[model samples]
Target: MSNGVSTSTDKIIVDRSRSHRNKAVSKAVRQTRERLQTGHVGNFDRELIAMHISAMLQGASIMPVFVVIIAGLGIYFTRDIQIFTWAFLTLSAHAINMLLAKRAAKQEITSESARKWRRILILGQVLIGCCWAFFAIQGCATCEGQSFAAYKGAMLLAAVCVTAMSNFMLPRAVLFSFAPTVLALCFRVALTREPLDLGLMAIFVTAVVFFTFITDRLFQSNLKILSFQSEKDDLIVELEVAKSMSDEARRRAEEANLAKSRFLASMSHELRTPLNAILGFSEVMSAEVMGPLNNPTYKEYTGDIHRSGQHLLNLINEILDLSRIEAGKYDLSEEAISLLDIAEDCIGMVQLRARAKNISISQQFEPKLPSLWADEKSLRQVVLNLLSNAVKFTPQGGEICVKVGWTAGGGQYVSIKDNGPGIPEEEIPVVLSAFGQGSIAIKSAEQGTGLGLPIVQAILAKHDGQFILKSKLREGTEAIAILPAMRVLQSLPAVEDALTVGRKRKSFA
Candidate 1:
């Protein structure tokens, strides 16, 4: 997690999490839209959207102008028909939206207030469409002439249609606002007796669609592109995050290596001090400088000192191998050794330790387990680590078993099992990681390095094989290792070729 403060800025980053970035961006986009709508921010896209809306309004004014023309005709005919009141009502309603558009332009009103007036205009248009339809139908039934009702009904429909087109962007409060207006206009247009002006109607509709829908969509798209460009700020924020993560990882690595170096240095000094005293005393005893002791206690004391020295030396060596493995400095050797032989040797080394506890140690080998190609030293270390751990955890009179077998069809596998208080199920995986010792082993064992199983895993993995650890509380532990098998003399020709090349290069030199 990154802290919000940069140590230089007084205003902290609101939220640094990536998951919250989308919401943050949406909020920012909304605020920007409102600000632009309210004449606060005049950024390019906002200006462009405003320009597009203005252009649409200008384009739509042509419809109202047409309505005004039709209303003028209606006024002329009604004045002669002696029905001036209804005609005035009809004409006023049809021309109201046109007047509203012009007044709205002069005031520079926002869409909300403009939409309110547009709705009111739509309501009036609906009434006019009904009136024209009623009068046109009534007059046509009798001897009433075309002067009062001729194209008047159709013109009313055209006015209502234009009103619906303009009211589509209204921001709520009106439901089905356009439907009644559109239906009334449609009925009035249906009742007309005049020839259909399809071309003029289509031209009118195409103009409205172009202004309200098509051009508005284009403006929105341009703004979306502008919004995308604004993401550069986000990318810069992410780059800073990635750089910080890289720095933290590097810092952790340096700290870990430094701590390892210090541990190795301290262990080296501690181990050498004990070793020096053991060797000095042993040499003195062997040289008869301590006077030949008839008593067995002197020999026993010397043996204890030797054992202590050996124990310290083993611990030191384990520390060194683990350090080397962690540093990835150990290279695999291309030696092909009998798998059974290595297995037997590892088992033999641990037999004495198990025997001292009266623990029955066993060995089993499947038929035709082939020789494995590996670094003999590292493989031996791998096997040795497993066996030592097995023996240490085995209780008195319990059993320690080693088995060598074929794995799949091409590899050799070995399993080391012990009847000790086994590892817990949850801790089995962690046990193979560095400094990961199980609670069971930690509870029972007199000593352990914790890195032993990790070293084994690292060693086996280098040979393109791996170890499997299975355990249960109070049962037993089993460790399995599988390695790729290489037939004898497979690398002999490569070795010979290398030798020849080296000799020839030397001769040329």
Candidate 2:
């Protein structure tokens, strides 16, 4: 009983050890197979495989013609039925292989499918090699004189040429196909036991080695060319995809902007109705048009209400105008207007506020400045917005300079400069954007809606003019609106005519 138990234990240990060893070997074999597969030509790109297959099909097409000529020669010389039979079989098999290769080239090639196709092609090549070997073995057996020697030479030459041509795509497959036939020829030549035949076989071997080297170089070159083409195709596809994404994003942004414009347009009337009522009632109460208020505080409160309502209404109007400009719906009534006149009018409009703030206003108007063809209302708004910003930002007792003159490039310009706390260079772009307030503006006592400069920019842009703002920290800010040269009206001749008419009238008087 003790012996049986020991035997059973030993058997169990042996079975477990055997199972573990088998598992290890299986794993190693799987890893090795995967490594070999990764390095195989069957793992080449699908497009490259298709290109090689197509090239092989073209070579195969020409091969049957060569075979027919060789077969005719063999029949005429040898008059042997076996040689003819083998040649016919070889031709028929090659035709079938060509058809299969054409079908494979047309099909979509994946890695596994490429491997299958390559194997089928290699098998067909080997069969053809076997037919050539049979022919050479039979033909060399019964050679008599120079005619047979010439025939054998022709066969060798044909084999070398076929191997070289077919191997351009896959050198290894061609080598496999032709090596057996060459070895068979060498063996037959060695059997002759002649010094000349041995010498010839050595030369044939050397030629085969040279042709193999050439085939390898050609295959590598073809691979590089196909890889570059594939990369170019990939880049083109990526660009097209990127362009499509960009266009989609742009289209969405436009739709959102249009929706915002519509919403602003629809709400304009609804908001202004109540705001107008508030302003009217507050004004009536502040002015005491109906009756006197018992409390002075009520009158003060009504004044505040009126002012706030007016400010709110102005902000709404500015927003609506900006929205219309962004939606490309702002219509301009073009007219010939004087830049000097517009600047003077804007300065006067802000004069009262400047005086209240104890800021001095200085003006320098260039004599005989040309008129500008522009929208009168929009141009007026641009100047007013700039002047208002200047007055609002300038400190008490600071200077505001307003200039109207010709630009250096023959255009007309209106420039407003103020000795205020100038904006920082980094903050300039921030202030130019709609509803964007800089840190300084946010901390100032005179709070604004932050839409003034943006409104000015939009209005000037509508007039085909340029609006530029230059500033330096702790120095000042200068805002210039320049009308383009195309909009500048030449007024020299008109001014001369007016002066002559005035002189004639004075003489007649």
Candidate 3:
């Protein structure tokens, strides 16, 4: 498929996937917000009821044993038969509560059903509380001269403590479970007006308040934990969605890149075949090799054709070079080469162009620099591209300074500086990108494919080197290509020293 069609298809796929993902995320977020909102109590109530029911079911079998044990002890202390009645009543209330929780758990617990079940459970707690109240108010007939009231108060406090710990999940149930008993204690203290009864009532009220506060705190903590867990689940879902979208984008990009590479690969041959014919035919016609073109206009037209074909061919070659480099197919033919010689050769090639423009070219080189292990053609291209750019931008009678020297890190560098209208600071990155020219370059009448600098940068990168471009508006531009120290092959010893060393090793052997 063509690049445009492939891009459109990828866009459609991405949009459809994003639309679905966005819808799902929005729905999830909306539902979570509704559940957590102050005005919408139904969802929150459902969750709370579900938790309470689970806790209630877990402690159901244990409640009866605890009731029997407490009642048996109470009977031994007070020697009253009514303790049996309290035990039976409390056990009945607990059984009713357990039945309600089981029913809620068995069915789907919606908000309405949760509210209804919570009320019924609280009522069961109140019934149990009334039984405890009766036990608190009853007197110990067989145990005279003993502190039975205090013993009753201690038992009531113990019951309150157990209720607080066990029923903290259902805060309302915890409050209602002990409210009646505390009320009965208050009434007993008011009617008797005795010091011991008043003191017991005081301690009982304080204990109830303390336990109530603790239950509320526990309830709040559970609420916070549930909220955090919900948020964490939401974040995990979002991260997964983002990751999938990223993977999809990367896959599409890779497909598009492959398509581009194939298209370029095919066009390179298709374009060059016709282009070479046009250049060859146009060269013959311009030279009047077949027959003298008597018309001056015909000769000029043939010359134009030849020049245009040559420019197009050069552009095609550059595009192919950049494509191969980007695709990592441009393997370097490493050999020991002199940076100074390469720079000098490139300067000589561009000397005619500089002379045509009346531009001055100066060279500076450090002597005795070591040879570098690199691809000679790629390095030559790098130096030539930089020189061509400098010559192109430098004005009439402008001076271009070229330098080759050692880098601070024991590497070699070739720098080409021109006294031309420099690029703007903001447009530096634009000029560096493929087919990206700065505003100034675009405005100028120069013909450029904007591939020169990018090709130079790519070639340097393949050599494990660096490219630096510094420009100031209306002042100048300097382009530097640097090769690392590892590529700088160190010089070997002389032949005589090597021969002596070889002879010494042979003698030792």
Candidate 4:
């Protein structure tokens, strides 16, 4: 029954439509975005439209020039000319209607008074158009079937057509608005053997009345489209604001990460120096070049000393690696590398550890696998760490397969799939973060520092490669490394050679 549909999804559909419109608007919104940057806000006010209309009309040109001049010339020649009376009378009525319409648009006019004014103005314009039409016809009728009749008839016809045609400006005003003029023109043309000038005027009057009707409807339609465009422009502004906020949030996150890295570095420096000294001194005592300790208790004490030192060293190394990764200072070397060589090396290094658990370490490679462009040592370390983790977690009799292959998009991959107690779903995300280990893993492993996966992540990031882990609870976990196959040559300082520790010691000398 209504022009609009009603349902709960209707609002959602409208919102989606608005979003669609916003995308189209964004391409043209640079100037609007700049304005909003300086903190401009827009509001829908009735006076805004009224003000625009007033501004447009302030410089509007109308046909009054000819009307005034011709009427004035006639009045002057006749010596008792009251050209002002006719112009003032006709123009005043038209002006009053325009003023009423403007104030009505602003709701500044009372309903009762507006209705009364509209009737009066409509009646007045019709009367004036009709009067001119009749007046023109009369000028033709009084003319003898001679020279004066023809000339005067022609002038009257033109005048009547102009007046009747102009009233159709409002389009909808055509119905009753042209009634009087129509009657007057038909009477002069068909009812009498008039010079047919007024008859010609009637045809033009009808056409114009209809013309204004069409234009007024079209103008309103265009205004609706303009309103929709204006709203779309507003939504585009909101999207730009959202984008700016996201950028600001990302910058703040970077700043926080930097601060965290700095704090870790300071902590490492303050704590690890004394730790290294303690380990070094303990190591000297345990070696016992003075001869082996005979007491069984003394040997156990030496073993305890060695074990504690190793644990402390592991902790120190984890902390340092974490800091370096955050600071983007991890030493990495990029070279053209044989994928097969790297995979075989990692498998060999970790074979003993896996064999200790009775787990077989096997390797597979796609035939003619492409060479990788990456840091070979870093890649080896990453593979070794992940494989070691898999072996440690895997039960006895489980197999660890190391597969290397070429990917479709010029990528080389090394995947380590293990028959191990896979990571818990909730723990996988945290494991990739610093110092994150699963509850079950932390309890069972006993010696894990929870930094291995993060280190692997950091290494892969340096190579512009991907490190991904897929695991299902109680199922095997797959850790895959994908590196670009193509080599990009650039002259860079060798990563290990660039380490400045020795240089720092020399500077002290």
TM-score of each: 0.55, 0.71, 0.78, 0.59
Give lDDT tens digits, candidate 4, residues 50-93.
44335324422343554565466545443434545556655664
Candidate 2: the clashing residue pairs are none
Candidate 3 residue lDDT tens string, 1-509:
01111122111111010122578768877876765553221236778879888988997877788778878877778777778888888888888888877888998988788778778778878888888888777777787664687677777788888888778878666668778877887898888787877887788878888888999998887877777666667668877998999999999988998888899999999999999999999999988999999999999999999989999999999999998887789999999999989988999999999999999887767778899999999999999999998998889999998878777677888878999999999999889999999888888777589999999989988988888898999999988888888899999986677889899999999
Q: How many steric overlaps are in each model, in order?
A: 0, 0, 0, 2
Residue runs of model 2 more than 4 Å from their true location after superposition? 1-60, 69-90, 102-111, 130-171, 181-259, 291-294, 492-509
- Between candidates 3 and 4, the one scoring higher on TM-score is 3
When superposed on Cα atoms, how far off is each prediction in RMSD?
A: 15.3, 22.2, 10.1, 15.3
> lDDT tens string, model 1, 415-492?
788888887788876787777777866777466767888788788767767677878888898887766544322333
**Which of 1 and 4 is ahead in TM-score?**
4
| Model number with the top lDDT | 3
TM accuracy, model 3: 0.78
Between candidates 1 and 2, name the one with more favorable lDDT.
2
lDDT tens digits by residue: candidate 2, 1-509: 01011122112111010122578658756765555444333235466567767777767657777777887877778776566787788888788778877889778889778777777777877877777776666644455666765676667666777767765676466566667777777887778776655655676667667777887788777776665555556557866897899899999999999899889988999899999999999999988999999999999999999999999999899899988888889999999998878877888788899999999888777777678899989999999988988998999999988877666566777778999999999999899999998877898987788888888878877777778888998899999887777898786543568889899999999
2 against 4, candidate with superior TM-score: 2
